[model samples]
Target: RSIHVDSPPSVPSLTTSYVHGTSSVSLLYQTVGQRLDSTVQRWPEREAVVCVQDGIRRTFSQFQQDVDKAAAGLLALGLRPGDRLGVWGPNMYEWILFQFATAKAGIILVSLNTAYQANEVEFALKKVQNATDVAFKSHSLTSLTQS
Candidate 1:
């Protein structure tokens, strides 16, 4: 009885490799925030953002600064990392930015559907501590309802 053994196939070597720069999540976030803030400061007169509503355009740069300030305000409100905050409202630019802001602050952002009923809102808020509801579209702080 004769048994024959076959040679294994040869594998090709990897000649090229991709290397990513050291961009830590925290560092990247700080860099982006600093860049945006610096640009806004440098071109204070220029429009940084525009809000198009009802065919009307509202210029912004100072507005952006204010948002960062407000987000920081939340950080100052004893809301530390992992703390969950709620933003209940229609889909708007502020809501999007709030998510960014929450990430920057390392806080958890729990968005609430504007169409949610009282029970839904209650359930959402009850699950987390330090939950603050922000009504940014209202333009007035009086509209803010927190639990």
Candidate 2:
């Protein structure tokens, strides 16, 4: 009996540089609220967001104003720094508002899927210890908290 084995061929090394075509730009080290405020100050009249389906449009200044109001509302609801706030809803203007509002209010925003089931929602709520859930449609803060 006899056995024979052949050694594997060596792979050719790539001479091309892996870092080619990559570039870096210095990013601003500022909070979301600070960036938004700076942008609003720079471009007050520029359109920031427009939801045609909802017939809603807002300029940078207007959007910042709304964000402030939303932040104030969260504060009035007793949301404080380090508090978790869940935002579960389909894409809408309110979602954007909440995103900025939570950032400004220093509340951690836990985003739940719009298609999440009751169990999934419950799991997320419990996991994050969310103080409040803001759902634009169908669900409300009271309903989520109660469950």
Best by TM-score: 2
Considering every candidate listed, which one attains the maximal lDDT? 2
What are the lDDT figures for the candidates, one per model? 0.61, 0.79
- Segments in model 1 whose C-alpha atoms lie over 4 Å from true places: 1-48, 54-64, 128-130, 140-147
Looking at candidate 2, the ten consecutive residues that score lowest on lDDT are 138-147
Please provide, for model 2 over 1-147, each residue's C-alpha lDDT reduced to its tens digit, 9 standing for 90 to 100: 332234433554657623222224444799999999999999999999998766778999988888887788788788897899998888777888789889988999999997889999999899877788877874232222221
Cα lDDT for residue 75, candidate 1: 80
lDDT, candidate 1, residue 65? 51
Cα RMSD (angstroms) for every candidate in the order listed: 13.9, 14.0
Candidate 1 residue lDDT tens string, 1-147: 433334433554556543333322333345445666666677766765455542222234654555566568778788887788888766555665676567667777888888889998888788665456765665432222121
* Inter-residue clash pairs, candidate 1: none
State how far residue 28 of model 2 sits from its true place (Å): 1.3
The TM-score values for the models, in the order shown, are 0.52, 0.76
